[model samples]
Target: MCLGDISARSQDQMILNLQGCDIPIHESQDFKDFSEIGTGGYASVYTAHWKITKTKLAIKQFFESSTKEIKEIIINEIHLMEIMRKKVIFHPNIIKFYGITKLKDEINYAMILEYADGGTLGKYLRDNAESFKWENQLKFANDIASAILWLHDNDIIHRDLHPNNILIHQHSIKLADFGCNASSIQLEILKGTREMPVSATNRIFVNLYKECWEHEPEERPDIDQVILRLNSIPKSHFDSKENEESEIIDELDLSDCDVQLYY
Candidate 1:
């Protein structure tokens, strides 16, 4: 996946459906007239409407390239979403998926998602940078923590949980993107009257990032654990050298959002 190969790969994504797969394709009726909302390292976001449902949706269209392993990743993502659709289960601060596209070998993959009105937390922070203080930061962290905890409690690891991954809608906080979801972290289970400790399983994520990016995936922090860490840091947290604004923003702490599993 050299830079030059991107163009050719992106063309496949322009396909509305994969033929012969009997995949249900919902091409944006106004595809040619939709608004480009944003772009990511590998995808483009658009605001589109579903004619049958007459509902608004956010479309994340990925660029084409055989190098990215997420094709299977996206396929698995859809399956995981289908299974975990209710995992969030009545939580007001999480985003919901509407549907998914069929898999393909020669085209860009797309996922239909529930659109957020307030935009990414990063963008909002920048826009209101001067006004964001400990009050807003703490509130945002609490809301996001609740959503993340819900995901972890359900046994799903959202490998990417940075500020950019957060979608805010008025008062609600929605966590988006699950391309790197890992296995569930079940509670210590009872097996034949014997108890086993998977404490390392809980620490798997930390292994992914204990030292700078210790990135020892095996040691990454789970949601329940993250809740404890976030709570331990006081709401008035501030590093004198970092400045008041920087300190507050710094404390919301997406510093360890990116984690990898260790061997």
Candidate 2:
């Protein structure tokens, strides 16, 4: 992300062509020709620029053989986004979806969202860990909590909430990738202990689906409760090292998940 020498040189280029761009999205298109920003079991994210607005956007492309199900999910997500986007909202920790590419095919589907320049929080933490102050970390934790609360207020559960999905922009936060987002009532996890501990040190992916992977769906905490847990995340509760690029690699290997760390 260091544009230093390049800032001196003239590298007028990027993954997606901004001067002229196009989309013929279908349920079948493979969404090729670009570096994948992120790849999960069902989808991959790409870096894109909106020609109309000339703004940076993160395009998450989902591949599905089931045409009906794909379209249904796409439509539902679009509707949910439309409702949530009605208000002008901004946060330092949550990703925001702009709009969606007009659905053309069943296999080709993508969501357009604001670009998270600093990349994933994991990457940011690593890049600045050497000198980042405690105040910055505290602000981040608080910002994320607020965003989760906002989503809950709207009756949506970011079932896949985690650090890698979170983005930072000039110290602001934006949560990204809502492919797994859903609207559902929540219960609780009898952790034997009083409540589920909101731990930031936990690796991102491992924590996002904490309750979903659990045998009992009832044990999953609802969005509101999730908000409380996030809000309760006291910065002073724990101390952490300045995240390093090395740590990012180690954690990814431990999680055994293939994902891009955009530090």
Q: For model 1, where is the 10-residue window of minimal lDDT?
A: 186-195
Q: lDDT of each prediction vs. the true structure?
A: 0.55, 0.52
List residue ranges in candidate 2 displaced over 4 A.
1-35, 66-76, 88-93, 102-107, 181-258, 261-263
Model 2 lDDT tens row, 1-263: 11111121223211122122222222213223345666654556777555545566667665653244444454455555555666576443555655445334433446766677787776665566456565565577667767877877667766665556677887877776554543222333234322233334444323544653555667776556655665565555445555542343334322311255531
User: In lDDT terms, how accurate is model 1?
Assistant: 0.55
RMSD of 1: 11.3
lDDT of 2 at 105: 40
RMSD of each: 11.3, 12.7
lDDT by residue (tens digit), candidate 1, 1-263: 01112233353333333343332345444333356776655567777776666667787766664234555455555555555654446467767676554233526556777878878777676566566655566568778888867766677777766666787787567877776643232222112221222231223223322422323445556556666665666443522232556544444433333321100
Error of 1 at 36 (Å): 1.5
